[model samples]
Target chain A: MSKYLLDKFLYTVDRDPELVERYREDPAGLVTWWESEMANSILNCHGDERSTWLAFTDEERTALREHDHVTLFEMGAHPFLTLTLFIAMFERDHGPLEYQIAYGKAMEHLTLPYPDIAT
Target chain B: MATVCAVIASTHHPFYYRASTSTGADRPPFADEWVAKIETFRETLTKARPDVLVMVGSDHFHQLWLDNMPQFLVGKAPYFDANWYNEEREFGLPRMTLAGDEELATHILRNGLDADFDLAFSNELRIDHSITCPIITLRPEADLPIVPIYTNIFAPPLPRPQRFVDLGKAIRAMVESWPSDKRVAIIGTGHLSLELGGPRQFGEHGPDPEFDRKAVEWIANGDLEGCCGDVTLDSLHLPGNATHGFMDFMLMMGVAGEGQKADHVDSLDLFHTMEAYFTWYPEGVPTP
Candidate 1:
């Protein structure tokens, strides 16, 4: 009935810088931990109606690790946080210009007006 | 009787540093001049010596989350703290505390509910820049006790602007009914026009001077309908991420009394954000 895991994952990473760092340090390990937590919570009868983590396929995990934003967006990740994650990733690797480019692409995907990047 | 009712509109986060600090490095060109004006305004507030100040501001997703965001929140805590984190700490604002007026706040909650306004009460609300920045700049000593009423602007299904005005009226009524001889001042903190965390987050796409000018004029003139009526969600959203802050201004104008004239108006255009300060004198209140 709900994609709680995906929502919680995106929301947590968006609001918590430390979690973002953990995810950046080890995406696979982070996802594994999340899956284990979900399993433990479900066993304890404290789970939501449905967990997206339980339904996530191997290909989806690969896409998440590969930074395929479109795939994640289609899978129901929050658009704003998706864009924020993209900018954060791009900024770390290729400076501010690449971050702007990533922002432009994210805006295009979200159908927001493209911004005139201030020089 | 209330001694003063003012609207101090400002950009909350990054722009807060512009007023709190003396340095202008990496800030907009108008930073120094704006800081000077705010300092003068602070002097006026000090001279007023209000016993209790009711501050209206909106939370920026720091305290509330998507799980349960309240439209209107009143702080009932005895002390309000600015629990800053990350970028908020960059402003170098020391851990600040403002005495809270629990009695007045409780009365507001009761009055708001009685007036058909469902209000959320918070005993542990941690304020963000929206309220703290203005306090640090205008009332650093925190001498006057404060009552904070938070309106929800970040999330959808935001209370209509008229609702905010009605809430202000409710608060005014509560203050009028109180038996105490305390002089109260109501200060609304927020921006006129600006965007944040959107596509133009880093661009010079806003502070729409035309819109800001009209808004300030409407507020100063105490024209509630002109300021908040027919304000569409699309219009607010299109302007910028945090343009919803205008709701706080509407609440302040409502409290200042309808059709009352502004005794003083200080407006500054900081390119990306327009800041307006207005003090309205209700009938028989001699201007200080």
Candidate 2:
């Protein structure tokens, strides 16, 4: 399912302020641009050292483009990454933890044992 | 030989710094009680007169990424620049730089490796709230030089719960044998029953209060036998998806040793999660 790539997308986007805003403002545009331009570029290495095989599945891309945390969790993308990035992007709109509470309630149907997050 | 003054474990709630420091209507109702409990907890370490600290905490995907994650890592730098931008954005944690004790970091790395643990070493490390949260709650002055140890509690394919306990025991031994006269306080922080990005998260209480109750009793009384018998990598998910972080507390239980009752134990049942603090005096309680 390329959960690692899904997490890598969240990890890279969450750390940069500009990217967080861009992703929030235009999820579809950011997702397309990230998959094409930034997906294979190794974090610490030069552009030439990029890994060629890393790409998101259609569902994974759709989940990111839609900002679908529920699908991300079901896909076993790292929960902490999803929660942190989502909070940064969305928490400001709501009053004091309202976003966090609603975020959890969204997946009320999911039960333990949650999806395995192992890479 | 160095004296292991205090073996302390706690919940590193990132929201604490903001909560405790806020004023007027901005301050949450629970801040006062949290601060009071923390002040009492802080005195447990202060009374011991520790000169150096061995800080045990896990990195929450800050500097160490999935590309090449280490199971256990020791930061051996001259200094550590604490807190991150995301932490600032989310938790409102201020930027801090704490002095690093390279000698103790070196001793732990060398001895920890010799003692059969393959630990990774970082010459430059920027720490996250896992380490700083305790620093804020317990030692606000942030004066003591520290040796930072990062564990992999967040990532999967994690080491067994037993490994965390074993490492704690090894750390206690290593510190006692460091050949320095400095009094060292070994401090570690982790969660009780946390659920992040799960259906059960951000609830009125922790995702599982029953688990939190049992977990606190296990730590307070130093019941590693009972704790280890019940806790497993797979079983931790029953309490909460993020409950694996409880292993860091188990690691401290190892440091406190079996049947070594904590001298100070306190808990605050805050919204979303419970905050528990524990302190054990390996060489008997220090005089105030």
Candidate 3:
């Protein structure tokens, strides 16, 4: 599981607002840096199937859009950070509720049932 | 000279309500019923007229981070502000302030250290939904000042359920020793079972209603030993990721005092999360 990546990503973002702002300013550069600085080390040391994530083609990296949130979640990303990243990336475009809905959808993808209670 | 002591507990999450609309198919069944139950408990709290509240809940990466999480952190600030993020505002939660009892909080910290519990103290702490939502529900008016105690239920190396109960006992002793005539109540807020961001995040088998019911029964009977002895970490985590929040209930049991049965118990099974409330009266008080 890439819980290490997810946890580190969440921890850094939650604690450092500047990192989040940098990410907002340059999503592609941040992703590239994350791949080189964070993900590469984790994958190299842990040696998981995610090793393939290192050699992503430029087109593949470009395709890594905001909608890939569920993919990240399924890959063992922390839910709080996954949602936080999603919000940071797309909250302006789709609004806040969209992120919440996306989280519910991602949780559904994980097979966790939503609580049957009114808002 | 502390007077009345009561335990108010609930399970809350920001996303639980955010994803669903107010009406139509999005609304879960018996939602109004759950609200009614909370309202009833709110009325019960108002009748008690507690001067101060000792709120026990866990922090969700708000005040503490993975690097410096404390097993037990007490707020010593005179005023605790709500950590309402923009995301939380989207769910209709407002940012607000609640009065904090600095003296009682300091006493609890000192007494806990004296009792050999290495407790962490925070002079400035922002509260998340874990306790804030319950405060809004149980004390919407925020009339009573609060002393918030944060337990480390999110991070690893979580204290044993028994430790929580023991901490509760320490808290009880501290509150009772206060040289004041103020009425004090303890509010423990958390879910029975919740698998947030875990592998079983969307799994139906994660929430066990039977387990929740049995837990309610144990609390109602004031069977702290039974709960501590029977409910293992594996059993709780097996049902959900954040089941560690159940430690809050154990803490509540400790505060309720020994042999003091819950005069009132109410529970609502919210599918993936079990919301429960229990009220324990002080010794020799007849249920009114």
TM-scores of the models, in the order given: 0.78, 0.99, 0.77
| Candidate 1 Cα outliers beyond 4 Å, as residue runs | A1-11, A14-17, A24-119, B1-13, B18-29, B87-93, B205-207, B283-288
lDDT of 1 by residue, B1-288 (tens): 443434344445445564446554555466678778878777666656578888888876567655577999999999988745533433445566788999889888887888888999999888877787768767877787889988887666677778878888777777777667787777777677765444444444353666777787887788877776646655765566567678777777778778866766787655456667776545343456
Top DockQ prediction, candidate number: 2
Model 3 clashing residue pairs (backbone):
A111-B202, A111-B203, A112-B201, A112-B202, A112-B203, A113-B202
Q: What is candidate 2's lDDT per residue for A16-77, written digit by digit as tens?
A: 99999999999999999999999999998989888999889899999999999999999999
> lDDT per residue, candidate 2, B97-160, as tens digits?
9999999999999999999999999999999999999999989999999999999998889999
Weakest ten-residue segment in model 3 chain B by summed lDDT: B197-206
Number of the predicted model whose lDDT against the real structure is largest? 2
TM-score (C-alpha) between model 2 and the true structure: 0.99
Candidate 1: residue B210 Cα off by (Å)? 2.7
What DockQ number belongs to candidate 1?
A: 0.17
Better of 2 and 3 by lDDT: 2
Residue A2 CA displacement from its true place in model 2, Å: 0.3
